[model samples]
Target: MSVISDVSIPPARTAAVSRRFYITAWRWHFYAGLYVAPFMLMLAVTGLIMLWTATISGRDGEKIYSVAPQASLAPVSAQAEAAFGEVAGQIVQYIAPRTAEQASLFRVNQGDASYMVAVDPYTAKALGHWDRRNGLYDLADSIHGTLLIGDVGDRLIEIAAGFGIVLVITGLYLWWPRDNSGFSSVLVPQLSAKGRQLWKSLHLSIGFYVSLILVVFLLSGLTWAGVWGEKFTQAWSTFPAEKWDNVPLSDLTHASLNYNGVKEVPWALEQTQMPASGSQAGISGTPEGQPVTLDAIITLARALGFDQRFQLGFPASETGVWSISRDTMSNDSANPLHDRIVHIDQYTGRILADVGFADYGLAGKAMAAGIAFHEGDMGLWNLVLVTAFCLAIIFLSVSGFVMWFKRRPRGATRLVAPTVSEPGPLWKTGAIVMLGVSLLFPLSGAVLVAVLLLDLLVIRHIAPLKKTLS
Candidate 1:
C-alpha cells in the first residue's frame, strides 16, 4: 500500500514539512540499503540454493538413491542394523521414508563426526553415506544461517535483518506514489525510461511486490537468531514442560534433539524440557509381549498414525526418552497443523508425552505455521512463490546499487548520501519511532545508536566527511 498520496495542502504551509519528511525517509533508506544490500543478496542466493537442493538432491544426500520399490520391504530393525553396520557408528536416529519409493535414513555418530546412512527399504542394504552437516544443502544452510563465521556472522545478519525492516519502511515512504503517477508507477516498471530513472522504477515496483515476503522471511529468520530469537521470542513462546503431567524432567531440553548443526525439534518444543524415562509415569503404547526395541517403537509410532516421514531420535543419556516426531521443520508433513511429537520411555516403551499442534500456545502455533511457510515446506506452490520472491530481492538489491552508481558524479569518492537538514518536529517523531524499534531489537538498536553518534559527532562535524556523506 502507498504510504504517501497527493493531498490538498497550501504549499506555503505544508510543502517544507512534506519535503523534510520525504528527505529524512530517503536518507534513512539510502543508508540502510548501503549496509543491508549485500546481506540481502547473500541470503537470497543461498536461500535459493538451499530450497532447490533440499527439494531435489535432498538434505544429507537422502535423495541419491533410486531403488525400485519391492512388493515387500525389509523390517525396520533390519534396516537399522544394515545402516549401523555400514557406518560403524552408534545409531542415534532413524528417519522413516515418507513413501515406499524413498530410502530410509539413519543418523550415525562415530566419535566426533556424524554421518547419514541412506538404505534401500526393500533390501535393507545401505545405499550410500555422507557427512550430515557437510552435504551441499547443509553447506548452503550453514552459510545462510551464520555466513560461516559462527556467532559473529549471526549477529551481523541479525542486525542487517533488523535494518532491513527499516529499509522497507523508509523505502515505502520514498516509493509512495503522489499526484498523477497512478498505477503505471506503482504496478509496472517503465522499461522505456533510461539510466537511473529506469533503475529506480524497477527497484520501486519490484521492491513493493516483494516487501511483504521479505518482511516474513526476516521475521521468521529472526526467530532463529541467537540473542533476540533464543533469548527473547523463542524463550517465551516455547511449549511448557508442565504439559507432561507428573513425569520427572531431564536436565536436557528439546534443543538437545537438534543434531549436527541441524534443527530437528518442532519449533514449539525446542526450549521445552525433556521428560526422563526411568519413571513408570506414562501409558504403554507398546503391545504386551513386545519389548522396547526399535521395532517396537516403530510399531508404536505407526499405531499413533506416524506413517509418513516421521523421525525417531534414540536416547542419548540414561534418562533420555526416545523421541518420535513428525513436523514441517523436518519436511515430514506439508501441513503444519498436523505437527506432532511423542516421547516414549526407552526402558518401558510407554508414551511419556504426546504433543500436537493443537497443544501449542498462540505464539507457538503462529511460529509453527510461519516457519513452515518460510521454508517453503507447505507445498509446491509455496516453493515457487518463495523462489520468485528471492529473485525479486536480488534484482532490487542490484538495481539499487546500479541507481546509486549512476547518480554519483564520475570518480567521486564520497558516499553521496542524501543531505540531512535541521531536524523538525516530524523528524524528531520519526527518530523516536526508530528508537522504539531499536529497543525492540537490541542489536539493531545498538547499531543505530552507533550510526547516529558517527553521523553527529564525526560525519556532520568534519568538513570532508560532511561533504562526502551529505
Candidate 2:
C-alpha cells in the first residue's frame, strides 16, 4: 500500500494499474509479432541462404570465383579484355580478386540485364559468365531487400522492420525480471516449465540474448529501405556535394551504380553526388593526352592503396566520371575504417575527389560499420556469429507464432490483443515511446496511423474485435 493523494492507495489497485501496463506492453508485442514474424522469418531464411551461398560458392556458381594460384599474373587490361571477349558488351564495372585463388570479375551490360564475367587474374582466361540478375546472390538479396516486388515490397518491409524495433523495445521491458525472480530465471530457460510457459521461457531467453544483434540487423537493413533510409536518413547523412571543389556535378548519385536491387556501392556514399568528367580541376592522374585504359586505372588504383579487393566502376554516360572504391559493403576489406571511394575525370583521368570512411557524417560512419556487421563481411568469426543470430531470429519468430496459436480463442485468430480492462487509457504509459518510434521511422509512423484509425473506427464498433481486444 502507498499514499497517492494523501489517501491510502490499496495494493490491489496499484497491482491492477501495473498489470494493465503489462497488458498494454504485451498487447503491442503480440500485434507487432503478428505482423513482423513472417517478414522476419523470410528475411532470416534468405539471409542464411545468402551466407551459405557466399561461403560455399561464387555469386554465379561453384567455379566462377575460384582460380588456381599462380606465380605470374596477367595485366588488369588483359583480364577485362578476356571477359569482354565472352560478354561482348560495355563493361560497367570491374571487381578485383579478394585472393590469388579468386578470379577477377567484370560486369558487362547486355540489353536490360547485366552479365558477370569472371576472368582468371593469372592467365586472363574468361572462366565463366552468367547474368548477374539471374544469379543466386541477387535472387536472395532482392527478396531480402525488397521482397522482389520492388518499391511496394520495400515499403512493407520498412514498416515491418520499424514496427519490429518497437516489438523489441516492448519485449525487453516485458522480459525485464521485475518480480522476485533471480537472474537465472530470465537468463536461463526453466526446464521444469511446460506447455506455453516452456515456449515463453525459451522465447524470452532467446529474445534477451539476440535483442542487440536483432536491433543491429533491423537498423542496418533499414539503411537500404526506400523511404526511411533513402528519403530521411540519407538526406541528413549523405556526403556533401560541395566536397568536390568547383567540379561540375552529375544529376545521378552513386546510387545509380546499384543494380538489380543489389547495393554495390557503400551505404555511406550512396547518395553522394557523382562528379562529372571533362574537368581540368583535378590532381595528377593519367598523363595528359594519354588515353585512359583499364590497365592505367588498375595501376593507379593499386598505387592509391587499393590492393587486391577493390571495384572500378565505368562511367555510365559520356560525362560520367569513373569510380574506384574499396568498401566493406562490397566485401573489399574486413575493416570498415579502410573504406574509401575516389572519383576520377573520365577524359582527363584526373583524381576529382576522394572520400573515405572518416569523411562520412556521424550517422554515415555508424552505418558504414553497421552494414559490415549486418552482412557478416568482417571475417570467418563474424560470419559464424551472424549466422547464429539469424538462426535465433528464425526460432524466435516460429516460437512467437506457436505461443499465439496455443492461446488464441476459437474464431479470433486473425490477431488477438491481450485482454486489458484498466479503467483509464491503455496508451497512457507508452504514448511517448510509440511516438518516438514512429517519428524515427516515418513509414512505420504512417502504418501506425492507419492501425490507430482501424482501432478507433473499425475495431471499436465491431463486436468480435472489441470483445477480443478489450
Candidate 3:
C-alpha cells in the first residue's frame, strides 16, 4: 500500500485515464482530509459524549424527574400547578411522562429567564428545576450542531460536512484495489508490516470500512445545517401548504415555536405556516364547553392517543394554536414513521391540522427516517451502530493525521501535499464534480473555489508548491 503507486494498471488504452483519475482522487483526498480531519474529530468526540450522557442520565433531564411509581397518579393540571408554583411563571409547554416511574416536565417562563420544572406525577410536587438547555448534553449538542456561535458556526460545519462527503468519494477512489493489491489490503490491517506500512495499512483498511457509513452519517446530520439543509433542501421538501384546507394561516410558522435551538416541531413542518386559531373550520378537538386551559389541552392530548412522551406546546399568541407533537429530533418517538404533529385552534378548540409521516414529501420522508437514524434515536440497535460509527470516525481521524505526518516529504517543515501527475481530461471531469459540489452545497462549493483560486493565485507562485504534482 504505497502512495502514488498504481502498479495495478495493466496493458490497456485507458490506463492513462485511470492513472490520471487515481492521482486526481488522491490529491483531493489529501486536500479534503487536511481540512475535514479536525472537524470530524470534534464531531465524533462530542457525539460520543452526548450518546453516553443520553444513555446514562437520559436526553431530557429524566434523571432529575425519575420518581417512585404509585398506585394512583396526580392529574396533569395538578402537575402543571405544582410546576408553576416552583418556577413562579407561566407554563409554556409540557412534556408528558413516558412511563409510570417518570415525572412530567413543564417549561416555565419567568420574566426573561426560562426553566425546566420537573414535577412528580404521583404527588404533583415539584421535583426540581434547571435552566432550559443548561445541561452537559445540551452544551455538547449545541457545539455538535452549531459550535455554540450561531449561524457562522452553522455555515462552517456545513462546509466541513460537505467536504466530509468529498473525503468519502475521493478516499474510496484512492482505496479502490489496484490489480497488484489484494482485497486483504482493503479489508484488513497487515500486522507484519512495520513503520509507515503499519500506519498505511491501518489507515487504508479503516478508511475503506468507515467511508460508506460516514457519508450516510454526514448527509443525515447535514439536514439540520442552515445552508444546504434549510436554505435549499428543506424549502423544497416541506409539508405542502395546500394540505391545510384553506385554513387561515398565522404569520408565524412552526419554526417560531422551536426555541433555544431545540426542534419542538417536526422537520417537515418547520417552514409551513401555523394555522391561525381564529379559523372556525376544523375537526373536533377540545370539548365544546370546556375552557381551553392547560389541563384541558393535556386531557385532549391524552384522549387523542398522545399519552406517554409527547410535547404539548402552549399557544404563542392570540391566533396561535395549542400544538401537540412527537418527532425523533425531540427524542420523543423512536420510529419516524410514527412521527406526527397536531394543531388545535386556541379560540375554537378545533383540530386545525394534523401532519404525520404520510404527509411529508419524498425528500422530507427520507430526511425523517435519516434523522432518526442519524441521532441513534431509533432503538438500542441503532444506538450501538451509531456509537460504533463514531468510534470508527475517531480512529480514521487519528490514522489520517499519522499517515500524513509519516508520509510528508522528510525534512520539510512546510506542506508537501500530493498533486496529480499530469494535466489531462480528468481535470475537466473534476471541474464537473467541483461544479456539482458547489451547486449541491453552495457554501462548501465556495470554499472549494477559494482553495482552487488560492492554488492558482498564490500556491503555484509561492516557493513551496512549484515542486510539481507527482
Top TM-score model: 1
The TM-scores, one per candidate, come to 0.95, 0.94, 0.92
- Give one digit per residue, the lDDT tens place, for model 2 in 450-470: 989998899889987676565
Residue 65 of model 3: what lDDT? 57
Report how far off residue 392 is in candidate 1 (Å): 0.5
Residue 148, model 1: lDDT of: 92
lDDT of 1 by residue, 1-470 (tens): 76887687767557678777888888888888999999999999998998899899765566777678888878889999999889998899998887777899999998989998999999999888888778677877888889898999999999999999999888887888875678767789898998799888889998888888888889888888998899888888889999788988998888888875577677779899999999889887787566799888988898999986889999998998899998988878889999999999888888899999999988788878988998889899999998999899999889889999999889988988777575555677678769877988899999999988998888878998787776
Scored against the true structure, residue 168 in model 2 reaches a CA lDDT of: 91
**Candidate structures ordered by TM-score, highest first:** 1, 2, 3
Model 3: per-residue Cα lDDT at residue 325 = 90
Q: List the residue pairs that clash in candidate 3.
A: none
lDDT of 3 by residue, 395-457 (tens): 889988887788877787665677555655746766677688888888899998898798799
The whole-model lDDT of each prediction reads: 0.86, 0.85, 0.83
Which pairs clash in model 1? none
